[model samples]
Target: MTGGAMDVLPAAPAAAAAEPEADEEADPPAAAALTLSPADSPPAPQVSEPRAPDSSRMQMPPGNPLLLSLTLQELLARDAVQVELIPEKKGLFLKHVEYEVSSQRFKSCVYRRYNDFVVFHEMLLQKFPYRMVPALPPKRMLGADREFIEARRRALKRFINLVARHPPFSEDVVLKLFLSFSGPDVQNKLKESAQCVGDEFMNCKLAARAKDFLPADIQTQFAISRELIRNIYNSFHKLRDRAERMVSRAIDNAADLLVFGKELSALGSDTTPLPSWATLNSSTWGSLKQALKGLSVEFALLADKAAQQGKQEENDVVEKLNLFLDLLQSYKDLCERHEKGVLHKHQRALHKYSLMKRQMTSAAAQNREPECVEQLESRIVEENVIQTMELRNYFSLYCLHQETQLVHVYLPLTSHILRAFVSSQIQGHKEMSKVWNDLQPKLQCLFAGPHGAPSPPRSPQDGLSPH
Candidate 1:
């Protein structure tokens, strides 16, 4: 048996086993090739490929870094800023809550009181002459009212967010510094910086050029819109004033009517003897007077309430319209400023190019100073490129900022005012209907006695029927 094991196996069986092993190794490569081959492989389960990202969703491109360091998205990022109110208890003389404005970018917290926000809002308005700074919440004389403070805290947060989102206002170095720094030192620094920026912006040649960028048609539109808003505001204000006066008069008239009704009642009760018809007439007149007084009093009360409500609504509409007008004006001013800067630069480039072209033409004509002509041509090309870029930027800024303001602020505010006005009219109609409904039974009862007949014709002696 050992000798037989040592002997070699049959060649055919050994060859057959070796061939199977080789075929197995080759199967892996064959399978891989088949998997890669489209014709041999089964249809790939249709996968819904992810759609390409929409370029429109991308944030505004960073244009001239010197002009703006942050995109609107970055500036308006919800997580970039946090405002918290920290309550502190001091000795009996000093207990206060501090408004902390924390900037994620600067990793700094600015501690301020409510008064500081008021000052900051004022400063913002003064510093950025054409920008619409958000209004601060009204100040409360009673400090440390928890609900009031909490409400104020929310408003302040929105106020800060609005300021930060405004491009020109947000880019102001002083504003950013104020938000990032604490203490009086920073305040003084910010004030000085703010004055410098304001002065520079106002006095610069750019400001002068801004008006040229706005077309005459656009200016006309703005003027027309402003006038319309002003007229509307004035009309509403007048209406409110008239309503208040009417309410006052109605209340006074109601009091006088009430007194007259009482006097008639007393006269009717007098027991002095009189003719039967005369007594009937006296009683009828007294009853009629009392009914008239009751109806007058009811109507006067309703009128007073309606007038008061109308006046309040009118006041609100007037105030809202006024605020909208102010915002519109601010938006116009900001657009003008931005356009001036861009247009001034564009015009400068154009002027430079023209001057260089003239110089190049003169040099070429002289046939003496080809090199100078070449230099002038190069400079002209540079100027042209700059001019083109500036023109593009001007259009982009106008469309992006001004158009957005019209859509977001102007249209929405106008629509809200119109809707409110319509609603007020509808409510007035409803209230008038209610008053008529309420007075219907009383009016019907005024003419009829308990038996629904003229109080039995008084002995038919008098020519006048009780009816």
Candidate 2:
């Protein structure tokens, strides 16, 4: 990742890398290419041979690791790259909210429309059907305002950053072309690259040997973590909504204060024809009118302060909450995929294998012709291949381990968010208290200057300062 394209992704064996358009993993090693002199190579994993089912313990046929050996830090890609999304209105009438996705990991800037994100997400789901693929932000056609566009941009940014940081997805031809290819038909290129590519189990390489690295109580741990993350997501989601509502109220209050100030100023400026009540107490009225006019300045200033504080709350609290929630959502998706997607497929494969085994046994026991028994045997072999792939996927706790580790690695973000939230709250309360403290003396000076002694002069450094 530190180097340019060549350095980030090593070329696969030359034969596999021949097509500039084809993915490195698109074409499996040709039969002839794998056919070396018996003395030149050691025996390969005998995947074609059948083995008895052993339900007592998890196991996989020994095979070469599918993926290159890399440290956890390398896989996380924490400091390796930066993903930036600059949004611009590209349509002639501002109908299109286009995003320019730029990354040091890719060759150049790629402008992606929301539709492009849609296609890219679909490809991810298709390629890694059982893996946790985060959902894209909902698309809308009629409402593309600056606010909506900015929110969607943030969502899309999170989506791409997560994908870019992932070791497998980072080097994936789908992602590489989506980010780098300068061609007009990027959607087509994405679709093409997704074809012929194997699933995550094939790419992960360590999936078959997951039991060797994972703990014995891996299932229990995954369940517990998933439950914990769900609780956090639910709680934080409510917190974010409340924070947003609080900011909205601040904005509304600011607008109301401005209106109040204007009305008060109008009352003070009415010298055209004094009302009967005003004339009855002309001396009192005249001075009171002057104070009323001056009230506008104080109210307007307070309104501005409220508006500024509202923006601070949004950045400090709501944004941070959103970030943490996004991570939680992804983890939840992983939990769901493991149970409903991968587990279900694995069960179905088992059922199919059992059915084929029964068919072969029945045919052989009936004293059937050799051709019939051979045909039944061949069908059972085909079913065996399906079982192997499914078994690898079912036991692939390695991906789960990486994802769980990723959650812990990024969990510190929540603490940073909470710190910022508290700091903003403290700052906001201090500002409000200062406003009331400063206003009391100003009111005494304006309304009681003649009748009562003027308030003691304030010091130069009377304003707020951190203790």
Candidate 3:
């Protein structure tokens, strides 16, 4: 019944019965022939052309899709960012550490100092006011020991990776410049790039209209998710500290084992060779003395094994835990930013607008000056800036909800991290079991019979009576 293209669809004889017979035409001689409309009008254009019939009208789509179909979750899953940080010596005395960054995102390697990272962090804060740009690690610690240096490097690497891997930040010009630019004036360059904060509405299409775009329960979902994540962060932060202490204890145990064996060797080497505790009867005491002398060597090997285990735990468990903590910590930072940064500015804008409204109203009522009132009216733009502030507030909330959802999406990483932890534990325990096995034969040799021949292994059945 519709006019334009459906009329030409009638030309297809196979499907013509689906359409009502046209008023303008009688039955034609052959059913396969084309049909035309009434005499008053020319035949409708072949609007429903056959496949491969035409090539002239091929064209690109009109514009970007009206809806936001791009998802942060899918983008994160598909895109990969590989970044490596190798800290090198810097400053005249070689007292400073500068990171040599090799970035897959840039396909380039650049040398950046702590100052460079600081500048870049400042720029990111300005550029993406609503995004969760994690805070940078402290610039310096009380003592710049090897542990501190390595920890600092890891923190900086993690922070950068978090920023780079984020979908919105991946396209940022500020990020691109900081990563790829190797100029002497990198500081100035970063400042110029992020000189002004961006307009929130321009960045988020439905920022001003979030009521229509976002879900009805999105606000409640955000609050619940944030609180859950916060609780997780608090619990896991303590857990991370406990994990660090566990690793430290392992390292300390390794060191203590080394010292313990050495101390035993020193005691055995004392000039007072046969103390009362030795219970030497002069005949068999020589063999016992010899065993004591070589005991340090056996124990030293065990200590070395302990040290290796400590290293394994550090890499596999503690590092993975730290990686997850970094993500949680960044979300924590984003939540704080929502309150202190965006909301604070929005409130200030409102306060300023109110003050201006009062000033303008009072000036007009008192008839203080026509020029003054006109100036106030022009600058105020009839509550124009307030409208922008309102939009930005809504936009900030929109981004906050989206970022919270992003955090939830990444929650599955905990499983992978835990799997790695269990594997490392298995490997570490197996290695220590091997060390114990090596010690068993050495113990038998130390207590060997008179000719220094090693004692044969004793079975558990030999110790029990079988009746």
Candidate 4:
């Protein structure tokens, strides 16, 4: 009642006090003949037009982000994307791993030091998306176009020539095959295709027909039909085809599988090439020596650590070193004795001296320790001089047949023997001397009784031997 709009409507005209009679059939003019305009026809029955789907809206179902996940690039840039990773189900990843491991070349070469670079590089490239990069041919030929082909021809020719300097290509069987062809054009065509490594012209059927063109010498060397060569080539081709298929499959899924595909795609390409170990170089020798030195140092430290920690390990290292030292001493003794015996045979001294020099050079190259290397070199020089002088002395003894100067011959021989004996004793002492020296103090510490009681006595021989 307080609202003003309620009172604004004029009060419905007061109902007339007298009512007029209405015809029963006419119901008050049928409610005054109501009519509706097009706009007023109950709002045109409100035929709800189908709505267009919302273009800018997105929705995700509960517990699943599949419908509304971020793009891979966005995921990568996130500071932390905690994903509940499940173990891989068996399929292509496992299959490729098995294939790779089962391949003999992969097993022997892929995991080793020298061949690993090639195997791994090739395998990674084959297994990764990097393989999608198309081969971009070299802009400039490394050699003349025909140069490579001619080089191959020359190499094959050289091999055939070495077989007997016979013409391997222009033999009687080949001539007969050409004659059978009924024209020189076919022969020229065959020659053209033969230059290609895997061309079908080199097939056995063609070779059989051309057998008359081959010389007897060539036939004797090859000893087989062109078919054999073709089959061999085809077999290799099949192998390569299979490998390519495997490589494609491996690459397709490498991202999630961690199969290292990028390395595989580099096979036979300019970008990814062979490693240093695959080729020879003087620098590689230096690297090898450095690696060996590092390994030696590492082993030495390991031995020292083991010595400080465990009695068994300490003994094991000492025993192995002792064995190695003993073997070296034996080799030195054998070579020294052999040199002396060879010197007595002056007629053969020159040849024997060369052999001894090679052995000495090898020993020098192998010896790495500063003191030991110098000592060994000095010893080798001394032995070489002794051997030389003895040769001369024995020659004089032989020519003069005199005992007066024979003592010179015997003296040098005796010096070598004495040196060998002293070296042996010194090496033996080096191997065993520290065993007790180090153990005595450690034993004293271990034996000091609880509450600082006096240490117990140990046998004098305890820990004296290296092993």
Segments of candidate 2 deviating more than 4 angstroms: 1-94, 104-110, 143-147, 171-183, 363-366, 370-377, 449-467
Name the candidate, 2 or 4, with the larger lDDT value: 2
Q: Can you write out model 1's per-residue Cα lDDT over 1-467, one digit (the tens) per residue?
A: 12222112110000011133244223211111111233222222221222233322213334321122333344345335667888765657766667889876567788877777766776776655434555667776456578787757766776675666565555566567768766676656656655534332332233323334433344334334334433443454565456446445545654664565456455545556667768756666666665665665555545555665456554445445544443434443444444444344545554564565667668779887457577756764565455343433333333322333322423345556667767765776677678768877766545667555644334445667565
lDDT of 2 by residue, 400-433 (tens): 5555555555556667777887787787778867
lDDT of 4 by residue, 1-467 (tens): 11222212111111111122132112221111112233212211111222233322222225321111223232223221111212323565431110111111112211111122223222222221111111111223233354443333322222211111111122222222222333425434334322323211122122112222222332222222122322333443454355334334423433322222222222212233347676554343333333333333333433443233233322222222222222222222222222233223432433444565566567669984444677667655544544443333222222111111111112232233335434543543454355436434433433444444646877878769677
Steric overlap count per candidate: 1, 1, 0, 37
User: Candidate 1: lDDT over CA atoms?
Assistant: 0.49
Candidate closer to the true structure by lDDT (higher is better), 3 or 4:
3
Q: Which segments of model 3 are wrong by more than 4 Å?
A: 1-94, 141-143, 195-208, 264-283, 292-298, 344-382, 448-467
- How far out, in Å, is residue 337 in model 4? 25
Q: Candidate 2 at 396: error in angstroms?
A: 4.2
TM-score, per-candidate, Cα-based: 0.41, 0.71, 0.70, 0.14
Q: For every candidate structure, what is the RMSD over all alpha carbons to the true structure, in angstroms?
A: 26.7, 12.9, 19.0, 51.4
Q: Positional deviation of 194 in candidate 4, in angstroms?
A: 49
lDDT of 3: 0.59
Instruction: Name the 10 consecutive residues with the lowest summed lDDT in model 3.
Output: 9-18
**Top lDDT: which candidate number?**
2
Error of 4 at 120 (Å): 49
